[model samples]
Target: MIDQELTKIKSSTVLVTGGAGFIGSNLCENLLNNNISVVCLDNFSTGKLKNIQPFLNNSKFTLIEGDIRNLEDCHKACENVDYVLHEAALGSVPRSINDPITTNDVNVSGFLNMLVAARDAKVKRFVYAASSSTYGDHEALPKVEDVIGKPLSPYAITKYVNELYADIFQKTYGLDTIGLRYFNVFGKRQDPDGAYAAVIPLFVKQFLNHESPIINGDGSYSRDFTYIDNVIQMNILAITTTNEAALNTVYNVAYGDRTTLLELATLLKKHLVSLDESIANIEIKHRENRAGDIPHSLASIGKAKKLLKYNPQFNISDGIKEAVNWYSKNL
Candidate 1:
């Protein structure tokens, strides 16, 4: 945060929707640390209560056990809030492929509900969690915000719809909004157990238990594995920016680099070996690639740097080390 804007942010009461999830809980922790009042809303469908349990006693923190799919719940959560950080959504491409209807209901319809609530509440800005999956089938090396391809999965479609709705909400309802298209975000508090668990944490969990992490392809597919701290900075910049040009737009939150699946597994094992020497001898395994997964994904963070002054501090290796350390004790 900029020194001048610190006071305004500290005094503001922000609503974090999905505040019990990995990314949302981290956002809550950072905001509370900065002396900001936070109102968290969640249905506990995907978000875990243990993620936000530590903050339950904080005087500045308020928890609303509600679902965004319900309009009344959205409206009620938006009450007395200065800004809305919309992080609630049904994530995972496979999950969406298995249940597209439920995904659309929560990701698209529920997003619309939150947009309506934030608009009516006259919140200063609505900063939301967009996804790199929105890049879709675009076969570009470095994905930019403007150059998007046709969505390959139901989850990608829902996230793209969010951008469309966010744009319309800005034009129609005069609600200032920012959409953060996050890449593969990983770090502390990220759950490693679930049917649709993210790759990094899931691999960490498997390696911790000396189990093989199945890589879909020949371990060649790569991603711009972003650290959670960088994502938090992007959101903070979105809500705290004073520049008019920075408003009503989307930004790619990533490390501006790429790491192949084999490379990622290697890095994880190297770091994890420090905790357990036997992990160094564990064999990394691979399998057939999943459908609709692109070969590689990298982001051009130039727009964020120029507009939001975003400077990501962690790279893939550093992020892996940090994440490995966390999983060593917490997982």
Candidate 2:
């Protein structure tokens, strides 16, 4: 279905910000596979060159080595682009807590610059990477788009602010926009070597190295862990959907389920042990819970299903198996 939609816009060009990062790089690869031209904008920062190396030589792929924090860079990348997938931003709640100024500068200021450039360029639509962090302290069992809570961290504030700015852009400037609130997305090419590394990749790397992965709490905390393919689908749907009611709204991009941290660790061990039986000996450790971390997260993907026809193909177990296989071969 998505392939058919892409065929209709194969002649179009897309500008993907932070296109060297995990999610952004995947988006570029999928778009290029569909024969769509892509302009990738990245300053490296947290994004790695290796992620985009495969696409660098493709004729349809163009790399714009620049920062989104600069309006000129944003404008340069937006030039003649038919659509914009704004994935550039400083991620991680702890990183934001440590340096709120930089987080605000890139996530907030940089986002604004992209909006202005997209509006000025008169792009068809602007689909961006919003975050489940926007749900913040809501305490809802299954998070909905309309009911949001106060942001618990600087990172959450930045993502929530994105939705606010996007709304204003649609109403005030007549630019079409869609915000996808991603929930703990993980998969191939995800970095597992950083201080702010996501849990799944981090644990997989640690187990492969015979190191203990320390859980922040009792391992009871859970999350709606989504796969990268599902996220890619949402972005494509947001860009392709001609439904007027779907525009200028936010949708939770998740698997519509939740998994406990302990369950996640156990599953990782089970899958990795299959690759190398010796990994079964690696112990899982526990530590105090990290500050500003949510206890549980689940998303109501009903809106995405009803509006954009989002049907997530990967569940947690299937996603973990694939992720473990990738780490074994690549890492």
Candidate 3:
């Protein structure tokens, strides 16, 4: 999603939780590029130092080694901040299925702590990462903003709860908040080693190593794999949008294009091979479908288009090409 022209706001100090994660790190870099001050809070659980290593010397960026689960840590991070981008979360459906309690602790309790801390700090706005999984169990062809279904997993529940809590916080405490329901975000700095690593990075790394990438289920499951730049645009718009009509709402942040996993791997391999022809022989393995995974996820960004003036610049092919180039140089 893109916001054409944003009003220059009064806030300079910004806090980004989970700032070392893939999307968070990109957002931090983009903000720094715009000459904005940033306070990054992270626990290094799933996030890594390498993601934000390039910014260690930037005077505009500050890193706080803290966990959002602790209110004290959240409070510390919120101080002197005008906006809070809450990206900290224990993501991954299978990971949550394996350990729902930890997921709940981080995604639910941790989110609440951030909200409370931001409210207490009198932050100008609080924009947090919501997920397209909130549309869970709904088999709609293209997910709209208003309609949603029951959360299918602990991760989904946690994200949906963020929206709920944001709404109540807005009503009860008068905190301005916005939620961006991200749909299958993937791009640069995305970790490829974790057990719950996203498909693109995992497949990219696997193919790079000349290893067979695994595809779950039949070759038909598709997703709206959004680019990191689009997500950065959404965050910038959400934080800067002063339109009363745009406040206190969740917008689907995606490219509105879907690609099946099988197709994705083939495309990735094509790109990787173009870079390093030796990897062209990399094969793909199919396995049983994962539990708690939606068969297809497609988002209708009409709401964002109409309300936030959102316009996505890259479709899946364009995004994948950029992502593959990043991985080629970095991973």
Each candidate: RMSD to true structure? 1.1, 0.7, 1.5
The C-alpha stretches of model 1 lying farther than 4 A from their native spots are 1-5
User: Per-prediction TM-score, please?
Assistant: 0.98, 0.99, 0.97
What is the lDDT of every predicted structure here?
0.92, 0.94, 0.90
lDDT of 3 by residue, 78-167 (tens): 999999988999989999999999999999999999999999999999999999999999998899989999889999999999999999
Ranking of all predicted structures according to TM-score, beginning with the best and ending with the worst? 2, 1, 3
Better of 2 and 3 by TM-score: 2
Which candidate wins on lDDT? 2
Clashing pairs in 3: none
* lDDT (Cα, tens digit) per residue for candidate 2, span 1-331: 7788787678999999999999999999999989999999999999999999998889999999999899999999999999999999999999999999999999999999999999999999999999999888889789999998889899999999999999999999999999999999999999999889999999999998989999998999999999999999999999988899999999999999999999999999999988889999888899999978888999999999999999999999999988888888898
Q: How many clashes in each candidate?
A: 2, 0, 0
lDDT of 1 by residue, 30-139 (tens): 88888889999999998999999999999999999999999999999999899999999999999999999999999999999999999889999999999999989899
lDDT of 3 at 273: 84
Higher-TM-score candidate among 1 and 2? Answer: 2
Better of 1 and 3 by TM-score: 1
TM-score of 2: 0.99
Q: Pick the candidate with the highest TM-score.
A: 2
